[model samples]
Target chain A: MERLLAVRCPGLIEEDESGGVLRAFDRVVAAVEASCPWVTVVRTGICTLPIRGPARYFGGEHAVVDLVTAAAVEAVEAAAEAVEGGSSVEAVEVGIAEGTFAAVLAARTGTIVEPGGTTAFLAPFPLAVLGERDLADVLARLGITTLGAFAALPERHVLGRFGATGVACHAVATGRSGNLPGLADPGAGRRLHALRHPPPPPDRQPGFWGGASEADARAAQVLTRVQGLLGPDGVLTARLQGGRSPAERARDVPWSARSRAGRSGGTGSQPPWPGAIPPPAPLLVHRDRPAAELVGLDGTAVAVSGRGVLSGEPARLSVAGGPWERIAAWAGPWPTEERWWTRGHRRTARLQVVTAGTARLLVVERGSWQVEATYG
Target chain B: MFDSVAPGRVPGRVPGRTAAPASTTPGGRRDPSALAALDDLARRIRPTAASGTRLLPVHPALAPLLPEPGLRRGSAITVTAAPGLEGTLAVAMALVATASTGGSWCAVVGIADLGAVAVDGIGVDLERLAIVPRPGPHWAEAVAELVDGVDVVVVHPPFAPRPAAARRLVARARERQSVLVIVPGRAGWPEPPDVRLTVESSHWEGIERGAGHLRRRRLLVTGGGRRAAGRMRRCELWLPGEDAGPGVAGVAGVAGVAGVAGVAGVAGTSGASEPA
Candidate 1:
């Protein structure tokens, strides 16, 4: 089916002052995806390329156009709202026609031309819609205000007066033009699947929130729900009871406490906590891959065991640059003290040294002096 | 040199009327007749290119210590601190704040010891900041890459490196016009740098009252290099806010330094320091 799509940034001019136009566009795309599963939203500069394959697969021209129109409008509206300080002013202008050029002209001129009426729809538009203002103005000077007027002139006369641009405008106005095909069909049955599952039990709902007393059970239930939602994705978002969410709670808790609790409260004595989730290790992921350590520039890596035990010897260290000389002066085991009773146990040994030219602080466990953190 | 002539005896009006110069130039130009007058005026208004570039003014105490009195677009400077996390972080943060004010891109490479809040407290624009955690043994290479991409790259090297690698990185920094600030983790460098500022704790006070005070020892600057044999200068500085009047003072001590006194007019001693 042929579809008409209109994408616009009503507050585009004011975007600098209020921001969020791009974010709104994202939401608009999301909403469109949610509503019209078969319509693909193309994001070229000023125009959208709607492929006809999916439209044809679904049915015919009218159905595709309707889907495209609905999706486009919904997306634009949602995007406008998503923008910070966004309002209804950022409305989209949609126009549909048989040809890509015709459709683009119709959209720019705010006209929706009926199918097979591309020539008539484009006829009234000024040649400026063709994106050649100079030629359009020249034609208008000769009393050719609209495309139809310009096209009515002799072909030789247009060519003689305005060159290729004039001739192109004439051809499009007369309904004899060539451009790229419309968007292909966005495959039928290729919609994003949001699986519907049974709601949580009444006791697990926010209405039944029981502070601390039911915190563990509720947390477990939330995790189970998240796992179900994530499926094999391995990533999950869980909504917990109370004012704060589960993710917020996890971040607020200390890493040391979570790590030392040992999945079974440590001390080799207790059963694993029902819903405790361990924190991710402090792993630094770089966008670019790194080479193995070079002699002078490489830094030592020390490993610390749980319960503040030091393992292995202090290895060679890496250097980037700075005052390596001064840092070397005091390079040794430096103790760090932390209150173990606190929520997050943060006792560590900081070895200060300079390698290469940079000064760094390599943190080891206070008791063991094994590596924990590095300041580069 | 015209001073207010007290009740002059020269021309128009009363006995107290002061004579106005008949010449067009307020202070007569140096014709043979005007030579003495011009010489006297020259003594009154001597200009010296304002001493430093107004575009980028380094702290007075730091001016003499740096290769130039001000940091330019394409220059590398390093700050060193005593062994510990606190001092190194303080220096790194100060540099970040300084670079940010100049609208340059600043990145912390291989340094994850600081909390975001602490860095922010030192006035570093966190929004424009990019922090990279310790990238293991290949830190120098990572730092070189970062330096190429950013205006300033602050790296805290663990300990000594082979002399060859250190020289290579230094060449890279000079080629790219990127500032490489190395926070020394160990002691002794294979080569001396263009400029080096060593930081040591003189004293710290006000911890109990929640108002933290850091008193740093004198900044010892050594110029040239081992081969060239550089000059050494030491200076003391304190951070204090400028008052409504003209004079500058040390926050907790008397402003003794002579060279730094004149340029201490900037408000807020947050980043103030005297150049040696």
Candidate 2:
């Protein structure tokens, strides 16, 4: 009679720094929502959803999990699309059991609990997670560590000391509270009617316009107003993105395909990403197609010697044809030897130098000196 | 066609942005204001972005080395060294580190010599990594599985695969929105890749012939192919570079998309010192 599915992400929510990534949590919500209507999300990325209805619809528990997994993948993909290069959801553990708590712990282990295995599955959990930290400490002091041990304690004694909270804990600890939380999706039963259908033209408000040209003028006026509300620069125009190779990476999704995907509400059915973190990269990665030559104080190239030794101390380099500045501080002459045993072998070195102007540059030396990179 | 050198040869690959009165170069590095505006656009979309990124985060050093911005999903690039490995794996790991640390899964499909310990030491979370050491005859199929399940798949084909099979794998990668990194080996790929990156050479600093230990390395990465075409981007970046040790691996990289005839090692930020 109990079919609760618990999905848990170990440190997801608690690890959020600015709470911006919290929006990504919707990836999980939308994923499960695809399979069932009754979902209750708890803190710590733990979600409990009743699967009885979905199981019936999908034919069995295995089939339901498969469908849920697929939906979860789609949700993750959507999150990736939204943030582009963000910290995305790549994996999740789902647990199915008779009740919420059991399913939660089961999810922690990343395995499924059979229909009748709830008791055996839960008996191994440490009493520390049994709720009521103070009581759990007391129980621990009394030599009870595992739920199996605490479950052996007399019910009357537990009731006498712990009272209502104790009884509830005992019920969960003994796997008797599997049916505690109510099972109904509050949002599932209520259908959203807005995007479902557009309002008919007959229901449109009539304007006091004289002719078609006047209506067109009014529409232009309205567009200006909307632009004002949304801001002149807020509307993002599609542009080609760049990368090292794929020409596609530089192109936007064709407008027609994008419209078709949007019309399908491919995203409408999904929820937003919550607490989803984006990847941490720098402001810009400048290329090395153009470089400056760094020379030592002696007016000679700051070269890595044939013996992989520096010819002299680094002194200066012209910046993009700008004036040459003195090197303030420097480090390196790291030698690199690749394919040494073959014909294409190369032996070279590099150095990190800070200029008197306080600019940083990575200089490379093969037969000549070149500024490899600058520190922002 | 997938050569990471001489990208200008490819057809249908146009300049990144239209030429403005000031946009002389394809990437327009000469236009400082344009670069500043691009940074502003990044801030507009995600203001508090870790590094003001409009694209995915790559090592600060390797950013400008990319053809456009940073790496994107659904893009496949081949990483090769003229005749050796030379920082190829190190750079690949750095790129993947951006996504992997953020909870995404990464899989290494065909490289058998790789061990989980060394990879874990390079900052890849072993828990999220799937290793397929020996795919044998089903190398392509194995990569397909990883592409389906993980976000980044680093594959070095054990043997030459048919062009049709390679194309199918590439299509799968696009459909699934996963990144496929093809590292060239003895057998080589039957067809060209969308993007090709080659480590033309590497310069190691902090070592004296055979005495001192190498503290850092500068990898000369050349990127070209259909996407880059005539506007090939070249850079000298670090790969775990000696000083990058495990702790600094995520923060390591230096991309100087240098041009030919002293025009190499262009402008940019230091990567080895910052996290992407």
Candidate 3:
């Protein structure tokens, strides 16, 4: 069976209609992209990705799930802490099952249907879940409220009488999409597009909330005065509780106590950031700059050129005609080749070099060489 | 600038025609109980910052130049130096080392030339450190984002500070309960820092010639701000003081606040004289 994972950010519906919330969500999306690629965004609050390959690569199904969930939470927490009222938006739900619809519903309903059990799991849900008002009303009149009871109807009559949407609802009610073959090939970029017209601007989405509520504004006031009485360092902090959804994980305690809180409760992950945390994370990292081209002592471009060869002994490098520097020591010509199986493949070789006056540089040679970071 | 402004005064407004405080309405009659209740509510609302923060560690040898030996959370502090990059940075790094080791996150912003080797030499935990070399025009917003997540935010704010941005960032820091350590940049903070320390004189002595590298620094650090109008104190010391058996709490009598100020050496130093 095809393996699918659903990710949900609950409580996304309720927060101020503000851009900060969307930016925070964007970080969560970036975090997801860091771990898995085959993702189809369900909506602002939900998304799904094919996880069979990653599950096998990273130990097992449970391990990859845990890794992705922890990473998503950490990123979401960091991004949320950047905005007002964003402190409590951290619980993220993950549900795994057979198809997109069932997996998302499982995430929303907080269910983790076991493998191959999609039928039995989705069978007992209420008819309102179908979200088809007219069809649901017709089914209700026929005394069919439970999905299992509705799915038991004759398929031909349901198709003949109620039409295609009714048949689709029946397919969803019974938890089966007959058209899609259970290919199980994760590398198959079959349905989900790599990118689509950018998601409607976060505010343009339905149910946008912007201004702060009276309660939040009131909380800010209470927090200020209590700190005055107790001293700025005397604030209280909330503990992380295991929640069904991401936002709910940051337990919503009363504001009086929360008012005395410290800078978010620290991302609070045991291992903190894992594989993705760049080594050392240089305390003096410069912002992304235009790629600096590296040239050899002979003055030719120092890269794995068109003929696929390291141009020459690496020596001089310059940033957009700014200045040139000498390379003192070096290592690595590690190659990264990806998606060769698909039409748009990518390949690049990276070099780690130390400059003469003591500066570490990570240079990637992709048709041309560009400096990525400095270490010394 | 914000601290000196009157409570109800809005910028550019005529003094006599200022807006009324939250407790008053158009009728113009002041309600005593309402005013008293407002005060109580105001008192109830001040949020506590870094409730769990303990005293950030300093070298045991230099502890007398501060009004409070312990760094307080939700406070803005300023440190000024006399030009040399290493000397000024040494003082800043020494102060950050203690807080970072204590498990708090610290970030340094806008001082683009800072190097990793220098920070490492000062003994700060690089794991807990974050650096933003160029914040561009949205410098205030960048620092505010970091303020919400980290315990200590050290910034040499970009460009001349504006009152509006300054007030907003300061308020954000207060809400998050984090400390904002402003290293006065090309343009200083729009608002005055709560605690300010200036390096009076910094002398590097260990490097004799081209043969040796810098090892010991004799620093004269003086501190004075809102906390000290008359009691401004000075300290002299080796910035990365030796990690010895115990830090001195000192016998207080000379400056009463000998145990409080942050200039480091009031107990005694090898070269320079210090303030009590």
Candidate 4:
């Protein structure tokens, strides 16, 4: 999760008929930009900036908070002076937390929640803070009032009961995901651009080689229809992140959200993991790992020792207790140890075993074997 | 650069432009310069290299197994493996990799456990690829919708489809000019496709008795279909062949290439009417 700082102006939030409030908000943005170069406009009067780098440069989070608050207050005062009969500017609110959604709520009360404490801090807040009226009303009727109570529901159950948007809200409530689709206004930046520059006369001819290609537009149309048919989570796109195993390395992100962010797709630079298996990666990574057994020539169950060494050479393999096939060739016991100090620590070893015409990746942990993936 | 000057804003247009003399001499000789300029204009206004009626490009290695030029648009191709072989999914991914990377949109439906790394390794641009892991009962509807817009639609029906449903999808693909690549795993496709690619036999190399890593595998792919693609062609490929460039049959890992020498080189033969 990204640590972000949010700035909210209560006075200039609602726009007046004269556009004076927006101009005042723009002044506030300019003032904040002087201190942090990456200030992003979340909406008309709301903005956010990342705090990690600035916090380091300014000595600590506390010092950066103070600096940002001072800058925002000065800007509001200047804007208040410029507009005579406009909405009177009030004290600027600034706070820092992990993710823009939580940071915005933190800014409302000028509270800087500690890092890794976002879930606990957000626990007692009412469902209204989630900004979903119908969902909050329904959840309230079921006696789930607080965000923490709603977060306690199993993720699959939440997804089944409330659909994709509900699952997104549930993820935010649980601190598992930082982004909620409706939290950031997609057109806020374009709105600001329109304000900064008066429009030129509309051109008659279309620009050469501009906009999305015809194929992209058509694909977007059909994908949107698919989303409508099977809900937002049904249509997904894969994003590759750095991890040890194939499952951990790639995850399915909702296609609608991915497209809205306007990110040019491709795997970005990922940190090299030391123990990850080399890449002529398996074509099929089994989601439900079927149980398998690997036995030696003597029919004794083969296992991996504490030193990551195999007890015996595997000679036969059976998946889900199906008919056993001769293991013509095999390799590995790539051991991985995760979170050793925690109670949830796990140690497993993986092997590549081939049968007549099929090859599979097998993992053994605590003297049991399961098929992890298949080379096919 | 010339386009930067908007047409409406350009000055000095002759009022009698439509009434101008033809670019030909009195003796009916053509003006070479004017003809060249017209040809340049036509070329500039043509559709992009990847679009229009042009065939979708295939990977250099797999090109020999398909029709003369490349994969035909509005055609259906079924990729199936022999009863015990497991390289059908690998073969299917190889078939679509080139078209997907050429800026065409491809979607995979009903493939729940798709390995993204392997797909990326096969060179399919992830940006243009969409996946509907489980469409459930809306399988046909979802596939039909995608076929309308996507350049390629690959589906594995969770259940056996009614013959009518299969035929309708084939018709839709033809109408939309999209390629349909079906992997029909357990629930088989009822209608025959234009090109049917079967993985005859496959064997892993470079590993024995737990000594070395799983380097690569050699697959025997035989292409057979109806009409234009009826001729049977056999191709021996080293999928994810040594060196990480996926699905290049005879390229890279020269030592491993000779491992399948006895698989009968039938690529150039009049390969037709071989028993299925």
Candidate 5:
């Protein structure tokens, strides 16, 4: 099961028509994202982030929990002050466990379940914790009120009675899968995306009369026409941001009337990252990562060590199983130890490899190499 | 006639715009540098109204490779490379970088994965650049529409554009007075362009087995086409010079530096000559 740490904002759990709760939740998520990247939003107030990477970075899971709990408290307090005009702040709850389902339950009671102990930790909880009111009522009527009792039922017998949802819940109860199909709000991501990239502000007006120059007005008209032919997301304007790789440093946002202002701003305030690839960024950053293979002089596969050293001196390379070409010259193994906890963690490092005619950025994750970008 | 209206304006606004007090003296004492300075002054002092029909500025290093002083408006320039050659896209980006920075709105079509940072590093203004990554089958229509308003439209057609469609698009660019740059990578262009620039080969320097990073690339660019651009021209260039901007290999001084450490790359030799 995927180990996850979940944050449950009890005050913001229920949807509010005013959108104040979601806004507050956004602050909490942002606060958490500052210390950790890739904070996944499971719902409006509830969120989960993978623990392996951060756990290792912050020393251990206990340290990460302490850090996140403090950050969430401060963010929630500030948000509550803004939303409710200085009402008493509610206590934010956080927990860590193997699966998101168990982790969220653990968050409600503010406890951390030890690894390999999720099923034991969840045994005493009532069926109501599953959030299935119908199943809880039926199970209560049958005198099987606790999760332990329901989990004790035969898998086939429960499926015969309760159908697919029952089978999924049973799997969660047995601690087999971290996923529950309907547990996460599918619309949360879209709603957050809308919040992050709102429509162009009214001040940045387009066309000839008021602010924009004549050329901008003409370009806006034709770009809008192209948008009509190819949807709104078709035409995009590029913006530079701070990141470790070429793809991360730059992003293409859909072109709009506001883009005519052409403010290609940089992340001036971003903290410097140590392992970022040196300048002269690649000409192309592949959208679909292509598989690659790097072999040493004797034809053995090359890899990166735990200490960021190359396992072999690469001499030949092939991409997507193509014919091998000699590695004429190469640069450093710019190692990025993002997540190196266990076997499946994304412990990857990048290298700039030049063949007879081309230069490419190759990343090796899980002992397999992939072409990340090309200096075309 | 309007040259004196902004007599000081031209030199003040443009860097490297020398007053050329020595050239003010008459008596057929003109030199090549003086004539080049006069030509530059003429271009800078030209009224904005005439800019609609005038050539768009290109990086000075690439000026010799083109038939005109700069990229001519209302024309098509196709960039191509041999099957396995690299740097075609880099050359195309370098071609439009100057005009884009000079306030020309440019659009890219059907070329996803364009490294905008590198484009910016090559001196292209990202703000004036719009990219239509995947126009699907409507790429021709998208390019046609963009060509109407955009000053330069760079398109890499996902498939071979029909000759008639390509001709019509070329004609549209001519009518609209927009420069069209085609990078027909794999999906070849059927219609003949006004000027076709091909990258014969590309070589990278500043990196050897496990040492320095990739610092620069040298490209061999050849230009040829019909009509005024009939004569073939070739130029050696660093598409990404030492500082990551394009520069003429011959004049950049760093050109003499061989691909070796210590001996070829002595301190202050190359850096002192590069343009600030």
Candidate 6:
């Protein structure tokens, strides 16, 4: 499918006269990165840049066009948020086309064109898009209502009457004009990923595990493993039950969101039930040290598992105002068993205890206790 | 309260009306008559006339053009200007300054061209001023909506279809009892108005450095339209200080124009002919 996207940064001009426009431009670029990983942002401003590399990388001009359109929309949304006045920014219109001039013209007229159809699309557009005063007036007087009519006029006659502007307009109308020189290429193919997992229960079997006693822990481990496999560019698609059906859900996802999953391997599996697996634990890798210290201040005792924990030491530790305090009382090997279906790495033990000062609950899996969940 | 007309008297002086006292004073004691006269004077002075009118000070240049010396509680005036940055800023500042002094809430609709510095320099109360830029194609309706709440509304004319809409806006101003200043382009409209003042550039001599002072201006003012062809007057106005006090002086041989010179300064030139 061929698609064209136009992104707009509304209120950029009003927000900052000097450097704000450039900042807004950077924000749009960042938003496109976050949303549509496979698409590239072509030319930044009114100018046009080459798209040959992006088209070749995406396997054809059609796919590249679709990817560009999706990324542009995402970028526009991001730009809107980054703007000073928030969403109240003036109306911003975007247009995508096969040719640079055609795309710009479409944006001014609030329309988008299909790939390889620049000539057909330019037919209805007014000649005012050229941004030249003299040529526009002449075009209007020549009984030319649309760009198609202007382009159909004899090239020699047009050039003779209007000079360079007429020649440029005719070239753009025909979609055979070269990309404006000296402009930098916006780059190619964004990194997008999407993944979905099956619901947890009797009906939906775990990846390699079974049963409900330690299902939560098994599910957490499986998700962590999957995240590792996807690498940094990958995005997991978590499909919860309720609302729309799976078929409808696929169509409803925005192009950016669809593209996010493309980075991790194309498409991920869907949940067995509509609302099956419990929501994934928040991705808490690389938690800030200050945040960890503050968490310690809550006076909650947590149990830790894995290689960091030492055996026979009191598994319960209290997190109070400053650092972790090893609690002498309220210690026990709570014993958490996960992934019973899988051998060797199937089961694990976690300890549970409450701190003395705050009486907060903490869980430690295996041999160590780190502040996990705090209870009143 | 003491009664001013009453006086103290000695008891049994007449002796049952048998004989007059051997006092040679003619007309007896005049104390009673004097007290009565005093009482009459007191009663006359007790009640004073109440003043129902109030004085409002405005920019001296705009004073004569307004129906009252300054803007009153209910009056509509239209101010138009050229399209460039200088002209728009000049008109916006003047209107804002006038409204701010009167303690009236002012609103600028569809006037995005005004810069923040220009608005601040004009001393518009930011708390009282509301600027709505690009109010869309329905600018007239938007202005009308603001009319009910604001005391004054200054609207910049749209790129198209402005003249007829301006007349409707004037009517809206009257309906809401709010003053409306329409900033028009170069073309002057034929709309009938209570007062029309045309501002034109003139050579101003003796202006202090960095202070806005106009020593002379061709201010064409025509009052009374349709009902009466009011008097037309052309006057020269000079600014004496930063406080915007007028230093009016009479010019010779100017007809149909009132010449108001500083009475104190013209004491030596009493016989000078006043321009009228």
- The candidate maximizing lDDT is 5
> Could you give me the TM-score of model 6 versus the true structure?
0.27
Docking class of 1: incorrect
Q: Write the number of the candidate with greater lDDT, choosing between 1 and 4.
A: 4
Could you tell me how far off, in angstroms, the CA of residue B245 lies in candidate 3 after the best superposition?
A: 14
lDDT of 3 by residue, A1-376 (tens): 3557777665332222233544565566668867764454444445667677678778777777787788778877887676565434667777787776677556555556788898787677766555455676788899998778988998997899789978887887777751121111121111111121122233342222734333233334533443443344322232233321112222222224223222233422212221121122222333343477777778877666544357677777666676776765555454555455888876656555544332333445456555544432
Kindly list the per-residue Cα lDDT of model 5 for residues A1-376, writing each as its tens digit: 7778998776665444455666788889889987875466776677888788899999999999999999998899888965653343356778899887888777766778998899998787777556565777788899997777888899999899899989888888888865665566534543453354333344543432556755777788988988887889998998776678778877888889875323234322223457788767888889998999999999999998978899989999999999999998999888886644767656678998999888998988878899999988
Q: Which ten contiguous residues of candidate 2 chain B have the minimum total lDDT?
A: B1-10
The docking category that best describes candidate 6 is incorrect
Worst 10 residues of 2 chain A by lDDT: A188-197
Give DockQ: model 4. 0.17
Candidate 3 is scored at a TM of 0.36
Winner on lDDT (2 vs 3): 3
Pick by lDDT: 3 or 5, better one:
5
**Residue B117 of model 5: what lDDT?**
69
Evaluated with DockQ, which candidate comes out highest?
5
Poorest stretch of ten by lDDT in candidate 5 chain A: A261-270
Residue B112 miss distance in model 2 (angstroms): 1.5
What does DockQ come to for candidate 2? 0.03
lDDT of 6 at A251: 16
Give the CAPRI class of candidate 5: incorrect
Candidate 2 lDDT over A1-376, as tens digits, reads 3657776543232223232223444566656865575455543245666677678888987787777766765665565444333443444557688777777666556557888888888787776555345566788889987778888888898999888778777887788875322211122111111111112254443232522222223223422332233343211111222221111111222112112111112211112222111111111123342466777677877667677677776667666677887765565555666456999896656555544322233445456555443321
lDDT of 3 at B99: 64
Ordered list by TM-score, greatest first: 4, 5, 3, 2, 1, 6
**For residues A29-126, could you state the per-residue lDDT of candidate 1 as single tens digits?**
45544433222222221233343443466586456546655665666665555555545434554455654466644544455566577877666665
* Candidate 6 lDDT (Cα, 0 to 1): 0.38
